[model samples]
Target: MPYDTERFDGDILFGHNSLQVVYFYSIENIIRGWAQHFRHDASKKSFYHVDTAIFEKLWRWARRRHRNKRWQWVKKKYFPKGNGRSWSFSGEVEGKRVYLFRAGNVPIKRHIKIRAAANPFDPEWELYFEERLVYKVKETLDRQWQRWRLWKEQKGNCPVCQQKMNPETDWNIHHIVWRSKGGKNTMDNCVLLHANCHRQVHAKKMTVLKPCPV
Candidate 1:
């Protein structure tokens, strides 16, 4: 995903107009490129790939070869979990463990604000958001969901005024425990209050809401 690295000069295009395709040589080009390109640096010049069964065999061989506790510790951290039929292998480079499960996808909500630019040549039909737009969109959606959930938990009432609240401009998440009192940033430590109620509580015009267990 680190596509901005200067090492790459854009995708290798193949075929002509009707059959044009972009080739992003990932595992083969990037992984091997790292190993070959950094050969002078022993700490960074390492790569490994093998079936689960082969990994187990190699692990046993390595264990017997080293016969020391350091190898045991390293094995525990670098080895990938294996299920009977086949194994997913892992390797290490510069003290970093490279494993298949190290990366994963998180659920993202639909419909979120994103900044984009349209292609000048295809302005009416093509648009693009620079790298990692999906991640940014997910983050925005998560914050919106958190705010809405907090509003729902408060039963749409302003804790200070003890009256029904309006969403247009009244809802805000207020910390139950004063931040100066070493309160943690957590859902249980917050409550939804009207913006006016928040100002009143801060100004001593309204009492602070009691810290309720969430």
Candidate 2:
């Protein structure tokens, strides 16, 4: 992620929040959105095909990082050269196929925003989008990123109750180790749950396991 240094004045620092912008391909992501049926196939091989903009940006970064290196060295180390032909990156991962994809593909069509200043307790900030086409951006982009990460990690099921969580409404993040106890905000420390299930866990009615199983 790039730093907010005076409106695009700072260096473009890549990989600050890499997980937010890079996604693994899943049935939920293909077909412009999610499909009703989806599963990970371990037999497939890993593949990567980035856009032109991404390719250029990465090449520029590589060049800057390896200022004294030859162009051939840069190409060999940075870009993928398969069969001495295809420049797209691809490989085998433990005899299984994986993919690295670009981010921010989720749709956000027509919508409305409201900031109710009178509601002191909540501020009543809200956004509404056309259900069939758009997503309602939550309070923060980090929240949305976490939602997508958890959704992909758990395959859209709440670990607490083993139930399907509503994409737009039901899911919530729970910290395995609380921030007050020195828990850092990372995938390993966070788990997704339904809002009710979250309450249940807090009430001692349920438990969540680290490295949550699907």
Candidate 3:
């Protein structure tokens, strides 16, 4: 059983009045263990892929059991300095009991705080997860690039020279406008240009434009 454990600093106080009962266990450990137990084949050593429903049931069961044991211990040892009846147990359910421990007139807040262990397998898991995410991003980018290329081919001729366009290496989409001149990346702003004509347009613009337009 591959499990990770960590010390939890906080305690859980249940019932109407608060009773301090500490619980310690990693929810991640419980999840991984549960996944491994219900894996498809008993003999085969493969990664587990349990459904979310089964995982939730197992996690709740484990939490309840741990809480029950801690509650019993606190209930047995509740002895305040002045009060004889320091604490009271309401009832027990599924091996766990609810207790009430009062401090003066006001009751302490009931809360359960569990610290999760730093998973050693997290780096490996992230590597796989990120790879999948990047693959989807790249696929979308490639499709958009192809669409832009096809649209440029259909636009007929170069906008600058008004010459017929060639598909292969000659025709390309020119930012019919320069992006630095507040031009948008939309297809309407783009124009098809032959490779040499596109080069001439850029070269001429660079030499003709004044360095300071002010």
Clash number by candidate, in order = 1, 2, 0
Residue 120's lDDT within candidate 1 is 24
Candidate 1 accuracy as TM-score: 0.33
Cα-based lDDT at residue 86, candidate 2: 44
TM-score of each: 0.33, 0.35, 0.26
**Model 3 poorest ten-residue lDDT run:** 7-16
Candidate 2, residue 36: how far the Cα is off, in Å: 34
Model 1, 75-193: lDDT tens digits are 65435454221333354545554443311111213344444554323312111221122234234555666567666777776767778877766355555654444555477776767
Question: Which lDDT value does model 1 have at 52?
Answer: 27
The candidate scoring highest on TM-score is 2
Tens-place lDDT per residue, model 2, 1-214, is 2211132112224322332123223211432222111112111111111133444555565577679999788777545565344443232456543433322232223234443442322212111111111134253454577668778888877777677777877555766765444555587987877767766676673447864463
Best by lDDT: 2
Which stretches of model 3 miss by more than 4 angstroms?
Answer: 1-155, 206-214
Where is model 2 more than 4 Å wrong at Cα?
1-137, 211-214
Q: Using lDDT as the measure, name the better of candidate 1 and candidate 2.
A: 2
Q: How far is candidate 3 from the true structure (C-alpha RMSD, Å)?
A: 22.0
